[model samples]
Target: MLDSVRLYLRYVVTSVRSQMQYRASFIMLSFGHFLSTGTEFLGVWALFDRFGSVRGWALPEVAVFYGMVNIAFAISEAAARGFDTFEALIKSGEFDRYLLRPRSTALQVAVREFQIMRIGRLCQGVIALVAGSLAVDVAWTPGRVALLMAAIAGGACLFSGLFVLQATMAFWTTESLEIMNTVTYGGVETAQYPLTLYREWFRHFFTFVIPLACISYFPAQAILGRADVLGSPTWFQWLSPLVGVGFLAVALRVWRFGERHYRSTGS
Candidate 1:
């Protein structure tokens, strides 16, 4: 495990250095990421501006959810760029080489690329988190602070799992499916606000099928000290973020199953 972690760190450092060699391109791409996501937040802000609140959730409260998911997803996107582009590896028969390596194939594939440009979206998330936390007037006790960090970590795991699952599908079809985007990118857009704002079926899909709400909505409720209309217990709300970790565990098992059954492209 330690060797794998060290290898991953080396991969990250190499990725950062290579990207930094073209600083101008890196800066512009990062800024583009930030600007695009900023517009999305502006739309959310406009909604709250038009209606003071939606379903009793004010802008500040909702911003917490927005910030957490964005931060989490940005981190996942940066770290899991390899999985996002795994189809290239399969198409070129590069994945066959991974199986021959002494180290874990999943680890090798995961560390194949580490995007550094995602810092822009990450910066935006931090700003939203800090500003929203201040405006929401929540008492930031030690426990609350810990919960906030845990929620972010769990969310990152959840998104990483989604990316792994997306890559795993290539083992069968040799092409990455577009439908998964509905659960991934779509889940990002959906989880950025209160789950209560969505309809029952939509909420159920996210809750049971995707469980995106567990990392953002439920944890945000605990952080905001708000009562859940769905009547989940406070203990459950506090622990919901861990569900992301469990989800990732399940996704990894599925990935292994797919990997074991893989028939190479035979370059």
Candidate 2:
């Protein structure tokens, strides 16, 4: 375990140092990432400005939702970038080599690449989180603070599971991965606001199928102590993020099956 940890650290250092060699490129890409996603937030701001609010959910409440999902996605994208590019590894026959390595394939793919530019996304998320915190006026108790952090972590796991699921699909299909973007990227956009505004079926899909709401919405309700919206039970709201871990667990199992299929085919 220590050796694996040390090796992953080496991978991190190597990724950072390589990017440092091209500082100008790194800066430009980071700026581009920040500017692009930041513009999308402006669109959300405009929607609220025009309509005043969606179903009584004011801007501040929406900001909290936005900030939470952003933080989750940023962590996942930054940490699981390699899974984001898993198709490339398969095409280049690199994934096969991974199976022969001492380290776990999942760990190796996770550290296969570190995208330093995701700092821009991380910065944007932090900015929204701070803005939300300032606007919402939640009573910042230690337990609430811990709950918020746990929610963010759970959301990240949910998103990473989506990404891994997307990667796993590549094992069977050689087609474009753009369709999966509908869920991974679309989920980010959808989760950026309260789930109440969405239709009932959409809400159910996110809740039971994808569980995006479980990661942020249901839990946000609990954090805000809101029982009137979806009317989910109080105890369930606090425990909803655990669904994210389940989502990730299922994703890994699918990934393992995909790996086995790939090995059998390669042989």
**Model number with the top lDDT:** 1
TM-score on alpha carbons, each prediction? 0.96, 0.95
Query: Taking the tens digit of each residue's C-alpha lDDT, what string does model 1 give over 1-267?
Result: 898899999989998999899999999999999999999899999999999999888999888889999999999999887898898888888887998889877788887888888898998898888899999898999999999998999999999999999999988886438888887898899999999989999999888888999999998888999889988899988999899999989998999888877853433
Q: Stretches of candidate 2 above 4 Å error? A: 1-6
Local distance difference test values of all predictions, in order = 0.89, 0.87
By summed lDDT, the worst window of 10 consecutive residues in model 2 runs over 222-231
Error of 2 at 225 (Å): 3.1
* Candidate 2: RMSD to truth: 1.5
